[model samples]
Target chain A: MRKKANPFFYLFLVVFVFFVMFPFLWMLLSSIKPLSELFGDKAFTPFSSHPTFQSYVSVFVDYPFMRYLWNSAVVSTITTVYTVIVASFAAYAIARLQFKGKTFILGIVLSVSMFPQIATISPIYIFLKNIGLTNSYLGLIIPYTTFALPLSIWLLVTFYRKIPGDLEEAAKMDGATLMQTYWKVIMPLAVPGMFTTAILVFIAAWNEFLFALTINTDTNYKTVPVGIAMFQGQFTIPWGEISAATVVVTVPLVIMVLIFQRRIVSGLTSGSVKE
Target chain B: MKNSGMEGQAGVELNKQDARLPVKKAPKRERQKKESRAALYLVAPAMILIFIVAVWPVLQSFYYSLFDLRLSDPKKSEVHLKYSVDLGRYLDNYPFLISSIDSEIKKGNDAAELQDIKEKLQSLDEKLQKDPKVKSQYNAVNDKLMNFKQPSEDIRFADVEKSTAEEFSKTTESVSSQLNKAAKKTEFTQEKKLLGLASGMKDSIIKPTFIGLKHYKEDLTEPRMWRALGNTLTFTVISVAAELVLGLAIALLINKAFFGRGLIRASILIPWAIPTAVSAMMWSFLYDGQNGIVAKLFESVGIVDKMSNLLTTSTGAMFSVIFTDVWKTTPYMSLLLLAGLQTIPSSLYEAASIDGAGKWKQFTNVTLPLLKSSILVALLFRTLDAFRVFDLIYVLTGGGPANSTETISILAYKVMFSQTNFGEGSALSVIVFLCVAVISMLFIKFLGRDLLNDGNGAGR
Candidate 1:
């Protein structure tokens, strides 16, 4: 550790933390204020004189927010689960086995990560409509899983490589088949890495707006992001309910980040940095 | 102790000994083949999914771009390879029109000219029925129409010869004009319905909408496309550059040994963890003209002339979005850079200090050179991400203030979905894809070579 911190460093930290935390703080505070207080001079006040949970009630009662939350949960959960399973198999293959076109496969994964989603939206929409999959959970899950595979595979490959080859050799010597060795031995060791990938994948699927907006336009299947985006009222903007919904959606994610901060950071930078 | 050089020679000798073992080579090769087969099986599911969802759709979009497909226009809704007729529509009008003309002729109004028009229409209908395929479909559609039931799609459209389609269109047009002239001279009750049915018959002759590459030509030359591309580039360059600087500063700050470092790190990630749409909404609220706190802060700090001006003006809206982006993404950038920073050995800084180097010199000499790859990787990711921005601009300003903030993706979406011009929108989408491809190629060629090579090596 350094001997002594400078005053300027402390000042920078204070300013940086404030800049980062202000929006979240504002969102939470604004969600609790009454509609009357939110519109006029009282909006500037950091603390509302009389806080109310009316907006929270309105989010669930007046609007179909419960359905949106359920829709988002289902889509994100399935996307995360499906992406992790498929990506783990591919990642294990690339990491443990010598194969032709491994580099080409990795290149494909990298390119898919950078693909623009708008370019593919129309055809996908047409396809979903033709197959009657639009306005269904599978519609969002399919695309979300496809988009999440690249990063999940990349992260898992790094994790799989860290496991010793000797263990697999030992398992093989014990008369275990290749699939048995993978399922019984390697997968157990990859749980931490999968957890990290799951967090990232779930967050991504939860936050995906474009595909959700286009693919599932039915109100019954609108996810949280789409629901909040398309939120409206007869005459007003419904900022209060929107803010309440945002807080509801974001708090769980913030908690997840806090709990898995180290894993998340390591998973994100695994392939990018070399020592 | 044994010499290290001798250990290397012994290792090579052991490999040679292994090679001499009997029947070792064949089984080893077989095992290797089996492993390769297993690897293929493992990777096939993921590759197939990606192909179906991502690759296939892009190719389909390219194909759709070759035609003029508009949802609002009934005839142009799908790809038409050749001239065809909506038989249901034709039967709906053709029989009614023929009967109306017959009644007019019986009324003794220009009998000779009306007789010529009626015979022409009969010959055109006969010519259309000469093709067996059209004849069958016409009968099927005519039956359905007579029963007052809607004709199914398979039986409703029939392919016709180009000559037949042209004659059908011409006869209906001429007959409708002649009826119009007769209606002016004589009192006729069915004249208005007859003219409408005649014109409707003309529309039943569907033309081929496949204008190959025409949309591409128009969009590539259009000023609106150029402006959207310009806006995209401007947003990408400015926001990425700002994030690089601010992220570097934050990365350096958080990398130091300090109190509450973990807490600070987690707190900063809050912005990134929030969904982009939600964040856009949050910023819009903050930038609201009437009651927004950030807008007021900007005005009081002299960043804007007024609180409302921040989101209402072109320059101010651009500045506001860029500022919000830098706020949201800088933490992610810093996190990546910090990973790179942690890999640098502390001994290098110590050696620099021993050589009488100051902080600035150490950053320039030791840190920047080693951190080049990380910086490039971060920039490549951020640049592409910023270029393809949609939800943020879509939700915040909605590409408004006279579309000064419309990016290529937003414009493509509007063209495709809002206006239902799928062909033109598809052309725009292909353009966006081309731009992304070019950007990726440029980055890979100039800066990301080592990063990609490292990716390949990492798997090995």
Candidate 2:
């Protein structure tokens, strides 16, 4: 298409791509290898050799990896659903509602979202534990809802703000109560924003390792990250086992991203809300 | 285009074109209190959970830091049986020996039948009481006996010497016997274990409690803790700085439309999107000194003449852990910065070019200042994350080779889960929160406002 290209530029790009993908590719490749081969004579190219399905089998057979996946799925789905429902109204208030301390409330929620998980996990763990929610689905669900609400509220607020007030005023004049108007009116229109918020909440909940790991000790209640971290710890960390499990686990997330490619807004994901 | 679209939907003023939208329609001020009450009620579930898990934890940890609490015992603050078998003790022992045995009355060397061999092995170990050579090798033998199998033939595992190796032979024999007994016992319990696993876990683990700040004070005052803290900060600062710069560069470079751009974008995200725990595990293996990829790279590049284990030495271990962390998180840093880059209006660039601004000047005067929010967000998130870093270090190095990579988070974990030192762990948790707050406040002072403001402009 052009004059001779800069070989160095192409080379740099190739190297960069390779560097970025090498670990994940290695992960996928290594997952199929037997433990012996994974830990074989340590060569960078150990991945290129004969691979096996032993690790995958072992992860399924030896551990409750499937339970972990189910836990993650259930938690993420509930969190996402609840988050959208809760946050849409909350954000609408912040964005369009006239109320005292609106800015303060919005700021508070935003600050909550920014609050480090580590800073909050200890106290949360104790409180949840006291309620017999520790190591329970209810415990995990409640926390997930709490942590996700802020971001959901923030993003949905932006989306709600973008919707013309006339749309809501018409419904309000129709004598729809606020809840009905929010559910039947603002919601039907904010599908795109809702989807964006849902995906983000799901991702956050799915990948959350800190609170999940600390609070839940039982494998059945544990989410994927904790499941995997603890799952194969008994054995010498089999890259094959971890890799295969990771693939099984991450494939769903990857598929989700791919299917919802439209939602993949690299900027804070959909840039659906301002802080 | 507008007329064509409006023609079908038009009965109700399709010509109305105001972008001003009411996010909410509040009633008169007289009814405001009623709405506020309703609003609080609606948000109660989420707020209550937040208070319980997030807010309560911070406060409880602070409160617990004030008094001694223990999990291993309801009376835990009492320092009885607090010490546990740990890496240091394990290393210092070089091998654990149960006891010494008198070497007498052994049949011919048929490697001893698995049962008799274990008995003989157990006795031989017991007789090593005063013998340094036998005792030193005792622990290693005992481990193999307990494990009942050979360590994998990874480059990561070095060969025990022949002299030490022989001791292992006897240990293996003992393990075979133990395995038989375990198999027999499990055969009966198989059905029960399958169903009772949940109950078992619940029974075994005691509930966690709030312990006071004794441990945090100890960590602060202790030289070892301070040294570890210093190392962690140094590692976090250097690696995070490198990652921020590198991520920005990479994101900017890849942001442009190019051949295979989609593929490259996904590729870059692959490393980031993979769980950090998985990456840490992979890198730890790669950092294996012998036959390791990292070692090979270093050797060939002449950085070091010999195959040096990055995990075995203090400085090397620190460097290895930090390098691995940077490699894994740089993509995330880049992605955040990239989002920031996209938010910047392209008109500014056009205007700059019209003003005769050079590329470097445009980047410095226009691009950088504009990207400030994104940079601040990226820096704040990454720095806070690095301080609490545990999964990576736990999987990669286990805060190893003399605890060089140990951060407050890891210490909190060990104190709570491992030692069952709830008081100490709670104290440490409060400290960790303080550390995070201080760092975050500093970030806010420096660039936090821009990042917060950027959030508004971020969501389109």
Candidate 3:
């Protein structure tokens, strides 16, 4: 049924995989090494003679990493939930209903996605400061939702278009109103699409650094990326602790990617590629 | 007889239904109107949120760029349309300075000159209190200071006429200089303290710093801004071109139905899944001067002359950043192109092969042409992203080794937060926004014409 693969194909695959995974492997190896070997000449050794979890222990004890993790989780969760709900409603209206100025609205959404965050950060910081929302979770959540809405809406619109229109017509024939049909009939069928968008938005919010760095500067409100960036030591740079923290923050994201690779790929490529 | 009766009844019913068609059209029109209204309701929340967070802030940044706003200077921290005076600062030093002068006059060292200076100071105080608004604010601030309570910002400053402000500043400056001269000539103990208070009073006069378009003109002529822009363009072009070639190769490799393709795809996402800041930090470690493995490898392999040369030298730092970016983002590029590759039917390849085309010929004739739109779209996204790079370079070299690697966004951030020059920073931000708009327009006009039409159809 299929031709046998060539030796060069496997060789190329191994090389590609090695190139992509080298950093992660190195990161993992470096995280497990003790400080003495990490900074000493033995650092070039492929494996440490005495690998330990001291860096991981120090990361949790020496810094307020647990708080950073909690903050990132809270902000990212709220942003993902808020963005998906609002974007879903807007996407449905554009996909399933005929409305005036639909093209104009889509244009606005598209342009907003391409807007550079640096340009809008100053006013956002000032506004949040005025309202006493800076250094709070709500400040980050609001901007994250605003930035994530465009992509989520675009992805959901593509998904919503794939569902047959006859289903809604059938619901209408059964005496269901427009709102009821949207709530009970269409939403259940669109759950997978919403889930895919949720994953993409969550990763985006988790990875957002600029707003989190500028807006929430208080130690109590720092997220993972900002917290890691601000790590320091008296004389030497704390490479082991930083590597441990990076490993801690990145493992969950890697697992998520592994589990939902297909969904994420489809969500990313939905608008760009033709079906 | 039954057939004829049924036919006659059916004909009568059809005629009645046809007569009611015009009447039914009214409700259909009303339903269409209601649906449009419902669409507005559904879209209102997202639109309002975006306007609040994104659109309104850009307008506010534009407005702020029109004035001189520096957080370091107390007087210029806030925008002032009219001349005003900080009564708290004025009252704090005014009473002490007057007493010091009076004490000097009592000592009778330069009694005649001191008397003349006292009379001038009295007239300046009277000139200031002549305004009813200033008098009330002055009294309130003085009372609060005496009671050891701090005055609020709103009541601390009071607006004054331009002429009155000019006279007050002039008298204080001259009197301070005279006092300094007197302190030098006479060994008066309180004269030093007196001069200190007098100099502090000079800053109480708050002049409006609303120089319109000054920051924009300065930034436009500034060599640093131009260099930063140039650096951003160089990074965007070189890194994107590298990613395109490598990503196309990876896409072609994975498009074949091979064993463990899923595992390869998943592993490829690891680089992309890591945050840019974290990756930048990782590369910084790998490129460390003494103990870095990658740096040593490069030196031994003859890519660089020394291990430390990777991040310490300007060209090497730029190369290091671009290399890290290509490593981090090639997976994303590959994925996008792979999506495009998957869309190409197998029959096309089969037809080409049947026509006696080789692998390279097939790729040139079929894959390149079909993948053009995807490549363009991917380049547009990656170019814009690379132009606005902040987290990577910010954490890596900090735009340093003499700021040779600074991009526009990094420069804007430094100007805004590190230096606390919001007005100039805002001007830079507006320029960045304009560049982004121009880039988007160029992409759409030249390369994305069909893509835009396709996007509109998909949106509809």
Chain A TM per candidate, in order of listing: 0.95, 0.86, 0.96
- Candidate whose lDDT is highest: 1
- In model 3, residue pairs whose N, Cα or C atoms come closer than 3 Å (at least 3 residues apart or on different chains), thus clashing, are none
Higher TM-score: candidate 1 or 2? 1
TM-score of model 1's chain A, to 2 decimals?
0.95
Q: Place model 2 in a CAPRI quality band.
A: incorrect
Please write out the lDDT profile of model 1 over residues B330-440, one tens digit for every residue. 989999999999888888999999999999999999999989888888888899899999999998999888989999999999998899999999999999999899998
- Higher-DockQ candidate among 1 and 3? 1
**Candidates ranked, most accurate by DockQ first:** 1, 3, 2
**What are the per-residue Cα lDDT tens digits for candidate 1 across A72-111?**
9999999999899999999999878878998788888888
Taking every candidate in turn, the Cα RMSD to the unseen true structure, in Å, is 3.0, 17.5, 5.7
Worst 10 residues of 1 chain B by lDDT: B1-10
All candidates' chain B TM-scores are: 0.93, 0.62, 0.87
Please give the C-alpha DockQ score of model 3: 0.50
Candidate 1 or 2, higher lDDT? 1
lDDT, candidate 3, A1-275, per-residue tens: 22366889899889888988777777789999999988768878979889999999999998999999999999999999989999999988887777898777877887888889998988888778879999999989987865799878878887887766666755654567779989998899999999999998888898899999999999999998888888856677898998888889878888888899999888888777765
Angstrom error at residue B84, model 3: 1.3
What shift in Å separates residue B79 of candidate 1 from its native position after superposition?
Answer: 1.7
Please give me the DockQ of candidate 1 compared with the native complex.
0.57
**Candidate 2 chain B: 10-residue stretch with minimal lDDT:** B96-105
Error of 1 at A117 (Å): 0.8
